[model samples]
Target: MNITESIKFNKLKEENEALKEQLEMAHYFNQNLGKELDKLKQQILYKEDFDVLAEMYYDYCLKDNSKYDKLLSKEGE
Candidate 1:
């Protein structure tokens, strides 16, 4: 190849190598992001389950207090 053509080819080859490295890094970053998204979805589901259970427990406590008050009144009398 002529001198100018050879220089251009070498520069192009270097650029290609740099682009490949960047592509690999982006793929790896995307995979990790996918994993993190899955984890976040699971955490949200767990939080929803916990919130439902807490609400149920609170409702039960409110209902039970009435019965407890009767027992206390009986004991005092």
Candidate 2:
């Protein structure tokens, strides 16, 4: 090969390696972003269901604690 061709070949080889590295990084980023997207979708789909469940648990705790309060008051009798 001519001297000029050798130099051009080396430069292209380096550029190819750099491009491959960039492509790998992009793939990793895409995988992570896809996972995050799935989680957000789940939250959007079930937000109301989760809210209702949390409210039910909160109400049960409040009622149970109030019953304990009544017991304590009666004990002071």
Which candidate comes out best when scored by TM-score? 1
Clashing pairs for model 1 are none
All candidates: CA RMSD (Å): 14.3, 12.9
- Per-residue lDDT of candidate 2, residues 1-77 (tens digit): 99999999999999999999999999999999999999976554333454567787876433354443333222233
Instruction: Give the local distance difference test score of model 2.
Output: 0.70
Candidate 2 regions with alpha-carbon error over 4 angstroms: 45-77
Error of 1 at 53 (Å): 4.6
Residue 40 lDDT, candidate 1, scale 0-100: 79
Write the residue-wise lDDT of candidate 1 on 1-77 in tens digits: 99999999999999999999999999999999999999975553333444467787876434454543433222233
